[model samples]
Target: ELAPRGYIAEGWLNAVRTREDAYPTGLAMPAANIAIPHTDPGFVAKPYIAVVKPAAPVTFNAMAGMGAPVPAQIVINLGIAEPGGQVEALQALMNIFMDTDAAADVLGQTTPQGMVDAIRRHF
Candidate 1:
């Protein structure tokens, strides 16, 4: 089944599971930070893309220990919008995080725009 807007169901579920993988792409929301890393539905070879977000700073083991969280000022919503665009989106995001200095700056920014600007530089 699908939504009136063409939102696929299977892909959504898979996205949730794929997001669960921490080592590859895991984050823990800091005490005053919040962030959501989600992907498109199409990224999913089976269902959805590998996307996940943490409600609170989750202590992910496989990834490391404490993954980053969402920006407290931003509303981090999760879901697969498209059918096959997740892979690229996620890859792009991963590439951005590859920079240790950049990721540090992004996760430590004080304001929302600062955070966004940090992300914009990635793409």
Candidate 2:
């Protein structure tokens, strides 16, 4: 999430991939298309969520240890701004993604504003 991509989903995936060698974006979720690209807070400056709706799907190293070459289309770039300011919020998201129902709820949300609203509520 160093360089942000507003709506280019593929480019956004690349940005996330650059940090995390394995693309955490397109994991095998119940949903059709999805991605979760995150890295250590060191690479980020201001913490904010960047959403990218790419024109086409992009491939990423899905299984890091497995060496399986799976790819994902959509990308969610996560940057931690003021890491100390958002620990609880970030952990909430981590927990959300861990829970199938919660992840579904997050993915079900539409529009950047929707995501923003959820983030704000967490804060």
Candidate 3:
């Protein structure tokens, strides 16, 4: 969807799917399980962050190892301009990720507006 909207490059979605196969994105937080799926910055048309919540939990291999699987309730997709931007964005994300209480509040967001509001508050 974002690809068509020019939010990301032509192969961005496929790139992320492929990269995720080799390097999983699952994060097992105390408050809620989350996944950060991102691809190379070259595939980004513009910098953006997208939040998604699945109707049912999805299992993804944990960042720790192949043997560990994390059930993700929410997924955060990041499209950063480059490596430097990726680092900066990730550092900001770490602040939210490390705090289970804050992360839970983000996960609790139901509507799109609510999610947008939550991100605004966090960032």
Candidate 4:
């Protein structure tokens, strides 16, 4: 979605995948397991955040669990063009993850606008 909009460079997906392999972004929370995949600013043309809720859970390596697996249903893809932008975004996501109600709200959305609304409420 972001590619056609020119928010990401040609190698953005590959770069994110490579980064994910090295430093996992999965977080196991009370409401649901989630993953925030991202790469360096060089692969981004514009800063943007994309959210995906898969029909089935996807496996991801936990960020701080020493390669432990997390079955994530919510995947957040980040395209950040600034050096420290990811930190702020991650902090906001962490806030939502820490609150079970907020995380549940985000996970309950079925539409794109609904998801945006849910995230905006806690973001």
Decoy 2 TM-score against native: 0.49
Tens-digit lDDT track for model 3 on 1-123?
686788997778789999788888887776678788899989998888988889988888887474579888888888987776766776677677678777877888889889878877886
Best by TM-score: 4
For candidate 1, lDDT tens digit of each residue in 21-65?
Answer: 543333333222333445454533333222223334543332244
Which ranges in model 1 have alpha carbons more than 4 Å from their true place? 1-56, 61-80
Per-residue lDDT tens digits for candidate 4, residues 6-95, read 899889888999999999999887677889999999999988889999999999999966557999989999888999889999989878
Clashing pairs in 3: none
Ranking by lDDT: 4, 3, 2, 1
Go through the candidates in order and give each one's C-alpha lDDT.
0.45, 0.53, 0.81, 0.90
- Determine which window of 10 residues in candidate 1 has minimal summed lDDT: 44-53
**Which has the higher TM-score value, candidate number 1 or candidate number 4?**
4
Q: Deviation in angstroms for 47 in model 3? A: 0.6
Which of the two, 2 or 3, has more TM-score?
A: 3
| Candidate 2 per-residue C-alpha lDDT over 1-123 given as tens digits, one digit per residue, 9 for 90 to 100 | 334533233344455557566433345444434455665565565566665546666665553444444454446566654546444644554555556655555555678677666545542
Candidate 2 local lDDT, residue 65:
42
Task: State the TM-score for model 4.
Answer: 0.94
